[model samples]
Target: LLSDGRAQGYVLNDDIFVFLGRGKIAGLPVMVWILILTAVAVHILLKYTDIGRNLYAIGGNDTAARLAGININKYLIAVYALIGTVA
Candidate 1:
């Protein structure tokens, strides 16, 4: 599809030139900045946020987390929403 230009109007292609400018950063495409920023944000969230801690706890042991007073259902819903948004 990319070879045929079918995906040309997609979000990345649509804004790549505008958002990334016409230059490279640290020998990588400027678009890589988005990936770096996203990684940093996720790292910070998992390291310092309550929701992130809850998510880790649930992943480690759902039964224990629920018994420990974490709202498993709410966190599951939030996880689903986050997955949907990222998709």
Candidate 2:
């Protein structure tokens, strides 16, 4: 959109759409702030959450994880749903 200017025709080429446009929060781009905040949140979740631990265990070994009483099928479905939503 920025490179071709096609978004301008639809009135969507404003500051929000343009990566270099003027709109900063605390001297950082809004997109950068969003990315930073998302990363921090994910880090915290993975570090301190039960689901996060379960996810790690599943990644290390599915058979062991299942044997250890983790619901492999449910977690796998949840993971796929999360991935689909994110993508």
Candidate 3:
């Protein structure tokens, strides 16, 4: 709705150019750092969190996860939303 049904994207201004183009830190581009940070965050979320355990359980068996009191619908929705965001 915010987009009003038209295409929406970055403005590609100086800040955008710097972040994705020539910007660097410690000899690595800013985008690289962003990717690394994102990866680490995801690792923590999927390795050390109760949500992660629930996700694994859901993956192994949705019915069992539901029986174990996990809200499979909410988890599945969140998982799909995350995947869509990444895509």
Assess each prediction's global lDDT (C-alpha) against the native.
Answer: 0.82, 0.83, 0.90
lDDT comparison, 2 vs 3, better candidate: 3
Report the CA-based lDDT of candidate 3 relative to the real structure. 0.90
State each model's C-alpha RMSD to the native: 5.8, 5.8, 4.5
With a 3 Å backbone cut-off (N, CA, C), the pairs that clash in candidate 3 are none
Question: What is the Cα-based TM-score of model 2?
Answer: 0.70
TM-score of 1: 0.66
Per-residue lDDT tens digits for candidate 1, residues 1-87, read 556855444454656566577558888877678678877887888889998899999999999999999999999998799778755
Instruction: Please give the distance, in angstroms, between residue 20's alpha carbon in candidate 1 and its true position after superposition.
Output: 4.9
lDDT of 2 at 28: 93
Residue 58 displacement in candidate 3 (angstroms): 0.6
Of the pair 1 and 3, which is ahead by lDDT? 3
- RMSD in angstroms, candidate 1? 5.8
What stretches of model 2 exceed 4 Å from their correct place? 1-9, 13-22
Instruction: Name the candidate, 2 or 3, with the larger TM-score value.
Output: 3
Question: Over the stretch 17-66, how does candidate 2's per-residue lDDT look in tens digits?
Answer: 66545568888987778778778887887789999999999999999999
Q: Model 3 segments beyond 4 Å from truth?
A: 1-12
